[model samples]
Target: MPVQQLRSGDHAFVSYADDDAGREVVTTFTWTGLARHEKVMVFSSPRTDESEVWNSLDAPGPLLGAARERGQLVVSSMRALIHPAPHFTPERQWQRIEEETGRALEEGYRGLRTYIDMHWVADLDADIAVMMHRESHAQHLFTDRPYTEICAYDSRSFAPDVLTAMHRAHPCRLLSRLGELHVEQTPGTVYLAGEADVATREQFLSAVREGLLRTADERRLTLDMSQLIFLSAACAVDLLRLAAASEDHGIRALCHPTGVRILRMAGAENMPNLLLSEVTR
Candidate 1:
């Protein structure tokens, strides 16, 4: 899912192939939390320098410095966090997180969020079984609580089986980044922006499918494509088929002239439940 779609109580997992790819999502996660008045904590990998994390978050402006000065943003490591404990234990770590969440709430923040690089597992020489157990059983931390977390796994560090297992274990999985296309959503609408061509066709379909499922019982589902720069013919056909399949619900698409033309050519006019509105500036 897009990072923008993540909300409180979402425990998301993301795996990255390199530092650049990893930083892309973490940067957005950190800044978004700060903007939402949520205390943000980043636990750097043992291999990463604290200064590098600080520089990445502060790239656009001095806002990160100000946030740090006020204690809204913290960049630290797992080793330091579990201090006074002789070794890594799930109970000990979870206890500290609960305490931190309470501290954030008491300090006048809306909530607390943490981005933990999974390299800490190796750094602490923790047992793989114990870590996996912790990951699968950590739902208690998020249930009915205002804490959000992202567990990042470095693809190069962990084996394929381990990565796949970890991915399935998490309740939420985050898209690496919103590269060429962006999808945003509300209760009854899914907004598509950027280009939806052959390359991004799958993503477009997935987002639209999710929106349809969410609004299945409602009278209408809106696809706001006012900001979409380009729509391919194949994608238009896919949209038409989806609308045709969901006979009971109406699909309303707000699009520019180009998109309208593509859909019209793809037989949008024949689908009774599909409504297309031309949006003009």
Candidate 2:
């Protein structure tokens, strides 16, 4: 999922292949948090210098600088967070996080969000089991309060099995970066935005299929393509094929004029289960 969609109480796990990709996520995450009036904290990787993090967040603007001046944005490390404690313990970490959340609220911010790099796992010489336990059991921190966190894991730093386990540990997972396409699903609808061409065909099909399965018992399922900037003919045909396959449920596609035309050219009119409705701009 795009980082922008993350809300309070969401704990997201994100993996990055390189520093560039990682920076893109954190930069966006930080700006989004600041924009939402949430206190933003970044726990730099054990090997990363704090200065590098500062540089990455510094854009060609004054917003970041002003946020820093107000103490709303902090760049720190895990070692500093659990200070006075000899070592890492789930209890200590959780206690500190709870205290921080309360402090952020007391400071008049809506909530607090942190981007923690999982390299802290090895930095603290902490047990992997204990770390996983912390990740899975940290829901209390977000139960009703407004707190969001992202545990970033560098792909090169952890083994495949460990990475997979950590991915499952978190409730939400973030996409590496915002690519050419994005897809999100709700109860009975699938929302498609961005360009949907051969490059994004598989993603487009997968989201539609999942939406169909989720809304199978309902009378109608909606494919919300009004936000879609471009739709390829191949993807249009894929939608028609899926609709044809699922004849029991009606698929209502809400699209712009161009999208409707693309589907019509792809034989959408012939599919009895598919209804194309043009959305006005």
Candidate 2, superposed: residue stretches over 4 Å from native: 180-249, 252-281
- Count of residue pairs whose backbone atoms collide, per candidate: 0, 0
Predicted candidate 2 versus true structure: per-residue lDDT over 134-226, tens digit per residue: 988998988998999999999998899989998998888777765557788999889887678888999999999999889878868999997
lDDT string for model 1 (1-281, tens) is 56655789999998888888788888989989988999999998889888888888788667677889999999988888888897899998999999999999999999999999999999999998899889999998999999999999998999898889989999887776555577888999998876788999999999999999889778589999866768899899999988988988898999989899999999999999999999964
Model 2 has an lDDT value of 0.88
User: What TM-score, over all chains together, does every model reach?
Assistant: 0.71, 0.73
Whole-model lDDT per candidate: 0.88, 0.88
Find the number of clashing residue pairs for candidate 1.
0
